[model samples]
Target: MLDELLARIEGRDFTIGIIGMGYVGLPLALTAVDRGFRVLGFDVDPDRVAQLNAGVSAIKHIPSASIAAAVSAGSFSATCDMNRLGEPDAILIAVPTPLDRHQDPDLSYVVKSTEAIARRLRAGQLVVLESTTWPGTTTEVMKPILEAGGLRAGKDFFLAFSPEREDPGNPKYSNAIIPKVVGADDPASRALACRLYDNLVAGTVPVSSSATAEAVKLTENIFRSVNIALVNELKLIYDAMGINVWEVIDAAKSKPFGYMAFYPGPGLGGHCIPIDPFYLSWKAREFEVPTRFIELAGLINNAMPQHVVHRLAEAIDKQSGRGLNGARVLIIGMAYKKNVDDMRESPSLRLTELIEARGAHTDYHDPHIPVIPRTREHAALAGRQSVALTPEVLASYDAVLIATDHDDVDWGHVVAHARLVVDTRNACAGIDTDKVVRA
Candidate 1:
């Protein structure tokens, strides 16, 4: 079965089914189509499926023209129906693995996707999970669910875990350019996954087991979370000392070999960095171990939004006699990062909520995100439209809080017009103005 799947992958004759069709899955589909593999993208959202069917991109960085080209060539298509799951030779699950209310790992999406695939299980099919999940999820959690049909994993159907390594707005290290890490408990599954990814990406890193691959992804995110937490802590300390943490980092990173810089922002954002660390920390508790550094980092990162909001409130009080009880604040950049529309786990959402909870009216402006979409965490903020960043609009607000430092905005215009500027991202660094206060 492995040999057959490997041959089909090498020949690019087999269809690839990608579940979720969001950031990770869409890029994977594009890369697969780019490599001449026909792809069927599955998503539960009917509207998203219809839009994709018409080749309209929902993401900012992924161009509609690319989707149109893929559709025109009959290389890719999106569907809400899961009945066609059996048609694909290789099925990749790239669903969301968000944290639950208690900040524990939520594997419902992964479980549901796996169950759907299990119902349509066929012999010689390769199933690879590309979701960010706790270790043993691919084996302990998903393996039993998949094998309920009595088909063995390695012999009848191959299973593996290859966590998605997608940087949403980064073109340099795209899904195609990034080396894939493929892991399976069995050699055949591992070999098949490696063979499939080898054809799609620049390189394939074959690990020993699925848990190791999961651990690799978690470790990468934890490293980031810890570094970002350190930087965030430094930002707080330096702020208290009246020292510029950004400047300190800039000079410190000049020693190329010794240091790698991680910038401090309003808080942690994106799918992996904010959430993946918790998956490891949660899983470690099962082994009767405490992930002290990771938990501390989470606490530090989580507190950043409150800190930024306090700074904004403080700026409002300092500018006028009135505090943030009824102040009107405009947030610059609603997106999590610069030049991207992805707002999953974005600090901006928390900032807006925090600001409003303190009796302040907050509106946002982002070049990428014009309308805030409905999210699990920030559903109340949905349907909110992005306000224009005109001088009149800027002047109307009591203070302008810069959450995301998008490169497209004219920082000079912002600093010139706003009464108070609380810069969370150092966005107005180039602009010389006493009005700008680093958050």
Candidate 2:
């Protein structure tokens, strides 16, 4: 089975099945198809599958032309049916591993995907989980499910863990450029997974065990969460001392050796940084270990949205001679980070909730997001559409809050027309007017 799979991969004669056509899975499918391998994408969303099959991209950063070209080449397909799972020689799981309401690891999607594959399990096929999850999930949780089909892992079939590293809207990197990390309990499974990814990406880093590969992904995110929390703490301190944290970051980053700059924003956004660290923390409790640093970082990062609201209130009181009650405010960007339509863990929504609770009228304008969709937490704020950022629209608001630093917004126009602007992302840096205040 291993030799046959390797031969097909080497000859580029195999079909790659990616279960979950989300931010991670879509890019993987496109990359594999571009490399001359037939690719099949599976998703529970019938609308998403239909849209992809019709040559439309559900994600903003990925162009529809690319999807169209791949479909035209007869190498890319998407489906909601699980019966087609046996068609591919290799099935990769890139489903989401989100947190539940109690902040516990929610592996429901991963479990469902595994069960779907287990029902269709066959010999000579490889199964790789690319979800960011707890360390022992590949072996402890998925192994039992996959073996329920009466086939053994690494013998009848292959099993490995290779976490997906998809950074949306990052032009400098892609699936083909970033190096992949593959690990498995068995040597044959590790080699097969490495060979598969090495053909698609720039390189592959092999590790001793699947748990180590899972830890690698968590460690990378934990480092980011901690460093961001450090900067956010510094931002608070510097704000009290009347020093600009952005300027400090600029001067400190000039050292070029030991310092890496991570800017302070409204808060952490996107899927990985805000959520992946908690997976490790949750798993650590099994052995009675306390992740104090992760806990503190989570606390600090979680409080950033409230701090931004406080600053906005102070600024609005000083500028307009009124309290937050009935203050008309416009948020510049709604998408979590800059230049992307992904709002997975965006702080802007929480900030909006905070401001609105104080009787302030909240509206937003995002170039990428047309309307606020129903989120896991803020479903009540749905149906709110993006307001136009014309000069008249800017003048109508009491304060314009720059929650996200999207490249398309004209900060100069905002500074010139708005009564006041609270720049949380430091989007308007050099504008020296009193209307432009750094939050």
Task: Work out the TM-score per prediction.
Answer: 0.98, 0.99
The residue pairs that clash in candidate 1, if any, are: none
Tens-place lDDT per residue, model 2, 325-428, is: 99999998889999999988899999999999999999999999999889878999888999998899999988999999999988898899999999999888
Tens digits of lDDT, candidate 1, 1-439: 5676778888888999999988999999999999999999999999999999999999879999999999999999999889999999999999999999998898999899999999999999999999998899999999999999999998999999998899999978888989999999999999888988999998899999999999999999999999999999999999999999989988999996979999999998899999998898888988999889889999999999999988888888988978889999999988889999988888999999999999989999998999998998899999999999999999999999999999899999998989999998888777778899998
Model 2 spans > 4 angstroms off: none
Query: Would you give me the overall lDDT of model 2?
Result: 0.93
> Positional deviation of 333 in candidate 1, in angstroms?
1.3
lDDT minimum window of 10 residues, candidate 1: 1-10
**Model 1 stretches with alpha carbons more than 4 Å out:** none
How much is 47 displaced in model 1, in angstroms?
1.1
